[model samples]
Target chain A: MPRTALILFAHGARDPEWAEPMRRVCAAVREQAPELRVELAFLESIKPDLRACVESLIAECWERILVVPMFIARGGHLKRDVPLLLEELRQRHPQTCFELAPAIGEAEPIVQAMARHALALASR
Target chain B: MPRTALILFAHGARDPEWAEPMRRVCAAVREQAPELRVELAFLESIKPDLRACVESLIAECWERILVVPMFIARGGHLKRDVPLLLEELRQRHPQTCFELAPAIGEAEPIVQAMARHALALASR
Candidate 1:
């Protein structure tokens, strides 16, 4: 059993198709690292909201979980909403370690990849 | 002067720092392809709205522009708001060619990079 889980947290949209890309990212992450339990959680309309995702993982005896925000950058939601949710989850599950990872988009490699994609697209 | 320009379109936020990553991508694209004019345009709460950016580029005689959305997925903002804005711009500048590139996040390599980042973060 995997002791650690990686949760991709994103701002969900009203349109169902909006989650398609995030789902693809989830699948890709799972394929790359099958050792870690991976799941997708949404901040809004999409199912398996953060709390629910954490609960399910905790039930599976996953003691440590890292939440990686998939936002393009740090914004009001990250500044205001996320901390509260994480704090509440911590209170709800004192035994489980629910850690907040850095904003995924802020990663240097990720930024470089986006830049490359933009440049390539522009060229095309 | 570059005949083609690339506009990285993003959903802006109230926080000034929210656009940092998008700005970095813009700068990286500029560095990668100095021949193609690259810029950042925001949908809200940021400077250089799409119209103003497009207008300035037109003034500079840049004839072709490719707008690449920095959004993670195709949502209501993209489906409803962007097309209308692009259409308005096209009408305002019939001579200019304003093309929409696929969403940057939906790009295959970008998705793979994100997956790799997630796994890397999970391991740490």
Candidate 2:
């Protein structure tokens, strides 16, 4: 059976603090899907760009990979940069199957998570 | 005459990288509201918590203050802890008026921002 992998992509931050939440979110996803291999990548200002991340998965011989954008909205990065990158990767790695998930901000879980955060604040 | 102040609140991150975006967002808001005094605060994992941020505004004698959560969602922090803090501050500083705005994630500008980021990514 081919191995499945998940890549959590975030906007690269020069400050480093913004990336922590992406780790937390990836951890949560891993906890939910222990069998799936998950990794993190940044668009800029960080190492392991999306292309490298995807190439690494291909080298690992993973037959399927899910790329999840940790961004909140479908901004320019998602609409333009990400798709362009994916297309480039797709052309380069025709054997690998890559599925792109919607940005995390559009996810229902985030709304629930935000509500939970708000409730926690209210309680304190 | 009453003065207006904008308080940009973010989830406190021990990592520090996450906070940079909050600062950027605050800067953008300040640019838009140059006449308004703007400040930054966190819910946890940082100094000058929300209460201190608000108290300082009161000390400055601002007649009205707007607190905007830089959080991505309406999580527990927004629903619970923030309101509790505001209530406590209200009780302590009855002379100062406060209005809490919705979390930044819900704002249309953010959606537009994300889309711009995505487009940028795609173009590259």
Candidate 3:
């Protein structure tokens, strides 16, 4: 089986604390899928951007890289900027299988969870 | 009884479709809690920014406006920019209570949901 890696791609921010939730989600995924390799990468204002992260993972002989966007929705960044970056990465590494998942927040299950959480917060 | 409103606050994007999930969440919230007034507001590149949303809600006799940030985490935008905007709203409407909820993504339940969703997506 080809070694597969899961990368949690997020829109980074200047505040270091901004990545806390992303890190937590990464940790949770790692815990859930102990057999798989998981990591987090950012778009800007942070270190180890998607390109750099992908390069290192490929260096470790990971044949497949799955990028799961942590964005709240399909904004311009996700629609335009991310695809551009991914295309560049794809061109640079033709052998690697680079897969992109839909933005997690745009998923129906996540939307329903957010709605429930909002109601729970307001009810308190 | 004082009329209370629920405002789903989000970081707006240029693409109108970026708000589709937000609208879905807002509609879900309204469906779950039909008695409460629910709406969506943006920080930029969209109509009815937070200030305008609050103003219109107040006009409709909503004495309390609960702003549930749809942000993924506590970034600089949430820590600094949102607080400044909320402060201005506070000064503008002393009678109306403006309650700012934590970013929905930062909440534990939402994080778990995202983690589960990510794992599911990768598993597929």
| Candidate with maximal lDDT | 3
lDDT by residue for model 3 over A1-124, one digit each (tens)?
5678989999898888899999999899889999888889999998889989999998998888989999999877777788898899989889998888889988999999999988876776
> Which ranges of candidate 1 are over 4 A from the true structure?
none
Better of 1 and 3 by DockQ: 1
Docking class of 1: high
Model 1 over residues A1-124: C-alpha lDDT tens digits?
Answer: 3378889999898788888878899999878777778899999999989889888888888888899998888887888789998998899888888788767778899999999988877666
Q: Rank the candidates by lDDT, best first.
A: 3, 1, 2
List, for all models, the DockQ compared with the true complex: 0.87, 0.06, 0.85
TM-score of each: 0.95, 0.53, 0.94
Residue B124 error, candidate 2, Å: 29
The residue ranges of model 2 lying beyond 4 angstroms of the native Cα positions read B1-94, B97-124
User: CA shift at A76, candidate 2, in angstroms?
Assistant: 0.5
On DockQ, the leading prediction is 1
Q: State which candidate has the highest TM-score.
A: 1
User: Please, what are the lDDT tens digits per residue for candidate 3 over residues B40-78?
Assistant: 999999888988888999899788789999989987777
Candidate 1 TM-score versus the reference? 0.95
Over A1-124, each residue of candidate 2 has an lDDT whose tens digit, in order, gives 4467778788766656545555555565555556667888998877789889888889889887778787644556777788888888888888887778776655544433433333333223
